[model samples]
Target: MKDSFYKYFNCNNKEELYLKLKQNSIDTHKLGKYLKFNQEKENKKIVIRGQNKLFDYLKNNIPDRDEVQIIMFNSNMEVLSDNKFPINTQFKDILDKSYVETANHVILLSHENEYNKLLRLEMDFKLFGYKIIDRIELDKNLELDSKNGIGNCQFTEEDIINGKNKNFKEEKKKINSKELHEFMDYYAKNELLGLNIKDDRKKIKEILKIANQEKSQEYFGLITYNKDQNITNIETSLFKGGIREAKIDPIIITPFLLHQDTDGLIIFHNHPSGSISPSQGDIQVTETIEKMAMRFYKNVEDHFIIGKNKTFSFREEFLLSNYSYERSSNKELSISEKEINLKEPVKNKIKSKEITKEKSTRNRLRSRGQER
Candidate 1:
């Protein structure tokens, strides 16, 4: 049976036995459990036998850290320590008084003949709520093996020494307006938006594309900037269309901007059916947002209304001059004639009213002729 078993497993020697056990998904922790069960069944101790390759592997990988606590158990199942406990001390006594609770990792080193003792100690530590992170068994010549008793306790040499893999590198990609334009064009076709801009110009271009999409409704795109005008975060929202109105509260975004230490913000919204002109509501909302931002020491960089392949900039067309003129002289708010005429909705409404009045006059004349 033994010959058949060894032949079937292709394990010729103790080294091969250890390798087969490791390769068969029987890790050190599971092996420890199996050994404990056998010991209890036979009412006798079972020792772990292995080669020194496992120990050498562990020594090469395990980082030397002050936070790691090493405990050595002798063949007699006694704890041996020069710093904390004396030689031939009882394992339970030393363990009960040890400072293993404060350690990040606990390494157990013992002889191959002491496997049963080591397994019992591991079980005890687990029952006592202490994690035995690493365990190694030594051969007859007191040499360490390459196999670790606990499977998940191993760490890579690079991870331990340098905190991360030395060969891993992250590519830093640059954002440009051309890339943004392409991305916007693609997403607009899908009736969706992707807010992943890391550049200011990229963010502005994306918002413009979203606003100018042919079948799109009103969408609000907010771009937050740092003190150096670098884009920090971008967000967007969809709103009901046809009414040509959307409501946004500056307070909803103020907390996040404050947390990010934002220095400025740029807002853009679409007017699906009208010209790229700022109405009275647009001006009022911009002023309200500006006031709120000022209270938090933030700046409103620009508010843009995108319409039918064109865009209106409030700062360039109105706010900058309005603020300067207001500071110079206190006066009622006034809008330029060009701005009013540029508003397509206002012109359409006026034309509709004139047509209605002309129809009413013609109908009254026809009614008088019929009565005569």
Candidate 2:
């Protein structure tokens, strides 16, 4: 089964990128537990796998960096990914984010010489146990000068043909801005938000038909609407996939949400097989983006799967449910600080943790360069 989590972020060679991530570290430290894969596969290093915090960070920073910049592993430890950030991206901007999956086996690419920034960066990644590969150290590993290593990763004809980067461009017909705008305005002016599911389902299906009409490959679409639900702002066909799979990504969709007026979304994709039924993979990504929307306090109105003759809606099917993440906040406590009673923001930094029936054990940890 295809998964957007495992989709390519770029065309970099996995083996070369992994060597850059693994063999090139001047110093190395480890963290977290070994776990079972969601399912087994041959050892491979994906360029980058998407995550909630990565999506959250990309919402604000991808423009400045042009792409993600951390090489880390998903919790399963099966896939190692390299994401390089810009020199100016500050550590404070992404400190202790809401992680849907744990990030470890990491190498943070940085070249900063600022003392406080370096110290803070070290302590922060140290807590998470991520490796920091600086300019000199990275240049030494790549067998090239600094910043030139990215181009060194080799690619083959097959890699480029099937790669995500190429597919995003070559999969769809190139329509000029005017042509795209006219197509968008037709639906926007028709009040797409007010359609009645009982009577207007056919009209909705007609729209999907036009959106993916005559395309032999699958592609993903994200439609953004104004806060009042009256106007359609942007309808972006983000990624094109093979005959069956398309990358349903959050970061690519985040820029639209950055517009203050855009509030609601409907994520749709066409199955070239002419079956509108949602696959397990489809269900997985719908839940993924839905949870992401909740983080922005936005709603994913529906997930639609379009086929030659039918359309399926996740909302109408009751396949998705409410997801709530308690926001970390500073507020006055009901009781004053007396004995065990805590006051505003009782912050706790967990040093170590374990779980067992008998008693929880704490692992020995190095605290600030000394073993404790």
Candidate 3:
């Protein structure tokens, strides 16, 4: 009653077949190894198709490290797509072209000279992607005369961390008289000692004093306390040039009256050139002052050799004074003091460093280690 014949269907499964053809002609079964589409449609030319949106999903969600592949199946479970074009081929371009996929970030590797140009470009691209730029290293490969050149590379992360840029204006705020005195003290202690001052110690001192006096007309003073704060003591050193009516830097010749309890001292003078050196006459005047200071109970501590950064200070070294003073013999002085029953002198205590909790915390958290 029936002839042996192959059957072909236009639909892939019973659901599609029933919906499209109004009939389910074959039993549905899950083949273990392959999806075998058994049909007698060799002459009828039936076709099966998958959703194109499946490719869009794969392109958008592929993992960073994995590759994607396309699969094809025939009626008898044969692979129909050509294997030559691997599914992973040009997958990167596909993802790159997709608006849904994006890179995590980008890095800039150009030199300082190119930084501005690159920065502009980077800003433009930042709307669509992420990026990081390197800071210029100023110590090397920096060109002179360029504001944005690598010359600025000397700045450190500490400079940024400390908010140097933000605090610049405040750091240079107007200074007070008390601060000026303390700064002078520190400067004298550190910059006016030893061999550096031995030759011109007296002269340097006189000059500094002139620079500090209220009557000084030409000299403007700048001194720093501790390390961060600055103080200025304004004075006129002299009238500029040979104009007789123009007052000249009157050489400061103040007597040393500081007590033994004084911590430090610095004296400076102004040269019309702003030079901080002693003239031959200045030297003689300084020597005379030194002799007078020793006569009293005072110390001629430090002399600054000022000239911008060309400045020098003898306090960094030790120097023996050349002058000899005639005084009462030590035995005679001792005998005179021994004869009197003297009441004990009250001791004055001075706390030089004020250690605040903020300072302690800052010290503890500083990137550097404590000094040995």
Please report the candidate that would top TM-score against the real structure: 2
Q: Sorted on TM-score, highest at the top, how do the candidates line up?
A: 2, 1, 3
lDDT measured at residue 308 in model 1 versus the true structure, 0 to 100: 55
The list of candidate 1 runs beyond 4 A from truth reads 1-207, 210-212, 238-243, 320-372
Model 3 spans with C-alpha error above 4 angstroms: 1-275, 291-302, 306-321, 326-372
lDDT by residue for model 2 (69-91), tens: 44455555433443334444566
Q: lDDT by residue for model 3 over 1-372, one digit each (tens)?
A: 221111123334333423432232332121100111111111232222322332222222221112222222344323232111222345244324322222333222222334454455346435555332222112223211222232222233342233212221122123233333333333333332232333654444433442232122233232211111111222222223231112323233331123323212234444444444344333443345445455553334444444421344433322213332222231212212322222111000101122354477788777465553
- Model 2: what TM-score? 0.35
Superposed by TM-score, candidate 3 places the C-alpha of residue 315 at a distance from the truth, in angstroms, of 8.0
How would the candidate models be sorted by lDDT, starting from the highest?
1, 2, 3
Q: How many backbone clashes does candidate 2 have?
A: 4
Which tens-of-lDDT digit does each residue in 46-69 have in candidate 1? 222232432333443332232222
Error of 1 at 21 (Å): 50
Which model is ahead, 1 or 3, in terms of lDDT?
1
- After superposition, which runs of candidate 2 have C-alpha atoms over 4 Å from their true positions? 1-202, 323-372
